[model samples]
Every structure is written in C-alpha cells, then in structure tokens.
Target: MAVRGAGRVRSEVLSKKLYCASSTPPPHARHFADNQCQSMESFFTRFKNVLVLVAILLAQTIGLAVQVRRPVESGAPDSSKVTLIRYWAVSVVSPFERFFHGIGYTFRHGWSNYVDLRHTRQENHDLQDQIARLRLEQASFAEDAMQGHRLQAMLDFQQHYVSTTVAAQVIGTSGNDLSRVIYIDKGSKDGLKTDQAVITPDGIVGKIRDVFPHTSQVLLINDQTSGAGVLLATTRIRAILRGSTTGQILINNLTPDNRIKPGEQVLSSGGDQVYPRGLAVGTIESIKIDPDHQPYTLIQLRPAANLNQLEEVLVITGTQTTLSAQAQKDLAAGVTTAEAQAAAKQIADQQAAEAAARSAAQIVADRLPSIHEGEDEAKPGTAAPPATTPPVSVVPKPLPTIHSDRYSPGATPSASDLKPGAAEPPNEKDLN
Candidate 1:
C-alpha cells in the first residue's frame, strides 16, 4: 500500500510541473512585462537623437584633425593637400565675386572720371608745379647718380636688373587678420611662382606664398611667419625684418648696443632672395631694448606700402643677372659714354689751346731784338746799343754756389740768408 501511494505522488508532481511550464501568465504579470517593453522602446527612441548628435560632432572633429595635421619634417603646410573645398568654393563663387567687382569697378571708373574732369585744371596746375620741383630734384639726382656711377665703377659693384614683370590686379584678401595675405588675378598660368616678389612704384608689398591655376596668395610683410632681409637706409646696417603677433613689423637681430633712430628709412637687403636689393621696405617708428630677450633691440617699422589697401601690384615673373662686363665697359672713367666723349673733346681742345699759346709765345720771343752775349753794356746816361748779329753760341751764365766754408760749423748765417718773409698759410675753410 505504501509503494502504490509514493508512485501516485510522483505522477502528480510531474503533471503539475508540465502544466506550469506550458500554461499562460496571469493579467498582472502580463501587464508588468508589457510595461517593461514600452520603457525599453521609449529609451531607445530618445537615444536616437543623441546618437545623431554624436555622429555629427565626430565627423567635424575628424575633418578638423585632417586640416590641422601636417608633415612633421617641414613647417610649411603641404599645398598639395590643401583642401579642394577651397578650390571648389572659389570656382563656384568666383563668377559672383567678379560680377560685383565689375560693378564696383564701373562705378569707381565713372566717378573717378567725373572727379578727374572736375579737377583737371587744378590737377594740371599742381602737376606743373610738381614737374618743376621734380625737374630741379632730377637735375640734382642726375649729378649725384653720375657721381655714384663713377664710384660704383671704381668699386666694381654690379646691380641686379629686373628682366621681366607682369601686371596683376588685386582681387581680394585672405580676410584673416592673422594671415594678412592678399590674392591677385594671376597665377601659375601667368608665370607667377611661389616666393616671387610683389611690388608697386611706391614700395614692396609682399611675396607670393601660394600659386594656384588662376590665382595666387601674397603674404604681406606684417604676418608673423613672414620675414625679410632688410637694411637701414641711412646706416646700411643689415638685419632681418620680421612680423610680430601684434601686427607690427620689426627689425630684429640687432645688438642692443646698435643705434637706431625714428624715421630712419629701411630697405630690402635682398639677402632673403625674394626682393631685389634696395627696394623700399619701411621706416623705423621706434626702438627699444627687449627685456625678455636680452642683448637685442626691438625696432618697430611702418611699412612703406599700404598693405591693407592694395589695389594693384606688379608680379616679378623673372630676373636677369646683371653682367659685370657691360657695366665695367660703360662705366669706364666714371662717366657715361657721351660724357666721356665730351670730356675727351674738351681735353683735346685744351691741349690744342696750350700748344697754340706756346707757339705764339715762341714767335713773340723770336721777334724781340737780338743782343750778342759778349756785347758791352751801355752807360746809364747814354743811349742803349742795338744788337747786329747773333753770337755763334750763347752760353747761360753760371749760377753762384755758396761753399760749406761760408758758414763755419759753429757760426750762424746772416739775417738775409737765414730769414725769409713769412706768408700766410692757405685758408682751408673753402675746401672744407
């Protein structure tokens, strides 16, 4: 009876376990499960926005990283890797920019013409006065230049001659104050190259930083990375000119002991190999000792070219080496060929005049009355006798020589022989 009861209990337990495993849940448990599912769906729906924002930020960060990363060897940014976005943007927007530029140009052109016509008479008068002044200055400069040419010839100095240039219109600027760069309507197609000089009649503006197919960037002298070899126009002290973060240009590498004055002109030294020697750079504004960097004086400069307001510029496409041989031949005798010819003619004329003078003087001497050397002298109260025939040979009278015995070793000479009339020394005031 006990075994039969245990078998019945096991069968009942198996049946309950099977039924519980297969049976559906009660209403409260089903509700709880449904609520948890709804919460998960809602949480994921909110997280979608966060994920989108993260994706955008991540993309921007990557782009920025690409832009900032550069080849470690050279500080210069690899131009080949320069963002094509800039080129595409330029290509798309260039037509609009050019249209606006054209409009501005037309208005400016008309207004300028009207104003020019209005001021023509006054301008002409002013120009005449300016021409007069320039003429006077030019005459002085011509003389000075002639003298300089002579001196240069003597020193065998040569000058670099600009062989070719292409005119370019200033189209726009980089619009970044830190860069201080400008763009022109010229590029590689126009023979523009990186590091070529840009200038105007007034002074040097800058140099080509980057060249594109149809445009180029010119870095002004006030950019921090820009440097130039410069010379003090007055002192001729060579130094490196650099730009500072403060937007000021400075003549650097000068010792603290160096003397610098305000308003002293600065010029390109050509040591940097961009600008030709003697191009105008700027003028000194102030000088002070740098406390942070000892033994160096800080010199501030005001650029000669108005870099901020550039409208037109000249691109130096090429240069020719000045042949020393030509200059050597042309500058012979420190004068121009025409001047040398004139000088030669004048010297020849002077020689001819001197020869004529000597011949005339000889003829007059020959015409004078001849007197024999041995003829007796007439008495003071009697008439003088005239010479009839010339002597066979005329001998000059011998000069009297005083022997050393005339003055004994210890004896002092007479006053007539020792004393001479004192003449005033020549005045050097005129020469000075």
Candidate 2:
C-alpha cells in the first residue's frame, strides 16, 4: 500500500535570490551605528543635569522619608534642616519632579508598547495559520463523519443481508509507497482470507492478496490480473470488467452504439469467484468501437473504489446478493417476529428501522446530488461547491480510446502484453 506524505511546507520568506559580488553592500544600514547615539547621549546628559537639580531639591523629601523609615542625624544640624525637609518633602517643586518622572516612564512604556505591538502582530499571523489549519482539520473530521454515513451504507450490507461481514479501514495506499495493493485493518484473525473480496460503501474494491494477523493487503480492482463480471446499471448489458495495468479498466466487448454511455453506473455481474454481484465498479467515461474487430465493444471503466488513495474500505466476509435496499424492506414486510400478540411491536420496530434508514439516506441525498451524463451544474444555479472538494472515492476515472491495457499499478507484465490478432482476456479490469 502507498504511504501518503504530508504536503510540503511553503517558505514564507520572500526570497528574491539577490546574488551580489563581495564588493556589494546591503540595502539597509544600521540605525544606532550612526551619530544618533551621540545625540541621544547629549540629550540624556542634559536631561540628567536637570534631573540632578531636581534630585538636589527633591532629596529633602527622600531625606524625610528615609529619616522616618530610619531616623538619622542631619550631619551638621543647621537651622534650615527641618524647614528644608518640610518644604521639599511636602511641596517644593513636587509637581515638576512628578512631571519629569512621568515623562521618563512614558518613554519607557512607549518603547515597551511598540515591542508588544510587534509581538502581537507576529502572534496574529501565526494564529491565522492555526485557524486555517484548524478549518482544514474540521472539514476533514466533518467529512469523516459524513463518510461514517457512507460506511453505514456499507455496514448496512452487513445487516440487511445474511452474510458474515467484517469491517476494515484502508490504512494506506500505493505509488509513493509504491505497490498495487491496499493495506486494510482486518486480517486473517478477522476472517480475512487471502483472495477475500474487499469493498467500500459505494461498492467492490478488490480481493485480499496477502493477509497478516491484524492487517491485510488488497489487490485493487485496478490490478491488471483482476477480473470481475460487471453490468451496466442503466442498460444491464453484461460485460467483463478487467483491470488495466495503468489502474483503469479496459471494459471490452462494449460496442460504441451500446446502451452504456459515460456516467452510467457499473456493478459486479457476479459470475466468477472474485467479487459478488451488484458491487458497483464505476461509471462509464466513454463508449468506443475498436476497429480491430473484437467480439464485443471496448469499454473503459473507472473503478468504483479509488484504488490509489485507499484511505478507507470494507472487506466482505461472504457473498452479498442484494435486490436493493428498498427491495429488501419490501421483502421483510411479511416476515413477522412473533405471532398475533407481538405483531404490533414487530411492526413498530420495522417502521422505526425503515425511518432510520430513510433518514440516513436523506443525509446523503441532501449532500450529494445525482450526476447524469455530461451535465456540469448539479442544478441550474446551485452554489459552486466550497473550495475544498471531498476526497474522491478510491475510484479511478475512465480511460481514453487507446489499446485498453492501461491503469496498471506497476509495469505491465510480459504475459499481459498482447499484440494485435492475439486472443486476450476480455478487458481484465480485475482478472482474479
């Protein structure tokens, strides 16, 4: 399975790559290196001289406070000593002295405020980045929650149908971590056998190629050798969906004039041992008629499960045969839990179950509109989706009209390189 890497961080530094010779100097000069310091010192000294005079006068007040705090002799007791202490400590130039201190304090506070403002601006920039990251995370979590609903649909297959099913999340994928495999949470211990079908909420993914005690690797439907019987949902035209080496499907035997068109749904026809029926393969991208004169028309299928970005998938324990969700509900109507007395409770429970299912279905319908062939806008003037598009299902898109042997995870094996006039397996989308 491929290991996804975190996106690389972009450098915020505005580097213009200014290359210069040794003789070249910098654009900006140092502020304090000039005679500014001399001027400041001269100013400070002048201010200090004024402060010294103020200090000489104000010493009386400090002197009195000090005397009170610690009684002291006036050195040489003069007649003006007590009077000087009284006048200076109480009123002599006290207002001017306060004014001086206030100016000095204001300067200090102003410098500190500027520093604080710079720091706050940097912090705000960081906080903006944090908010953007948090929004991305919130969207991811919300998507995961919405995906929980889709999983509920996959899990619904486990419930309505009487098949032993185990759930698993796709922990990793391939390419960066290059391999044509998907790593799943389930393993041999969880009844995940080698070659067991792995799928998702939408439909079939692939089979377990290898299994460990707690983890298993899935051979994606995009695998060259992977093959499953598939039919168009709209046309019900049966065709063999096989994996391309390029990780798409070479839907062969589909004529250009056939009912299948781009965007038509594909599902497992369920003939071979690979996957069960009704497992959605993907939508048709284009219809083609190869001039090579093959028995059937050529079809290119996009996988239902996104094989490359295998973030999550489900592993089917046994074969699943579904008429439809609606069909199953209709079928269960006659089957009562008990006899006449318990009938009311059984009906209530069934109704409640149906209501819950409808509600769950409603959430999807509200978020996802049905897509028909080649229509751009979901409806006429529906708001464009938010900048962030949801993670596409592990599904791959259709291929162009080339020799359909494409979408392979790795190099095409020598045996799969069939030339013209050679009988090859009909569009091995996932030829098991």
Instruction: Give one digit per residue, the lDDT tens place, for model 2 in 48-85.
Output: 98988888989878866754532432111223555454
TM-score, structure 2 vs. true:
0.37
lDDT of each: 0.73, 0.60
Winner by TM-score: 1
Clashes of each: 0, 35
Overall local distance difference test of candidate 2: 0.60
Residue 326 displacement (Å), model 1: 16
CA lDDT, candidate 2, residue 219: 74
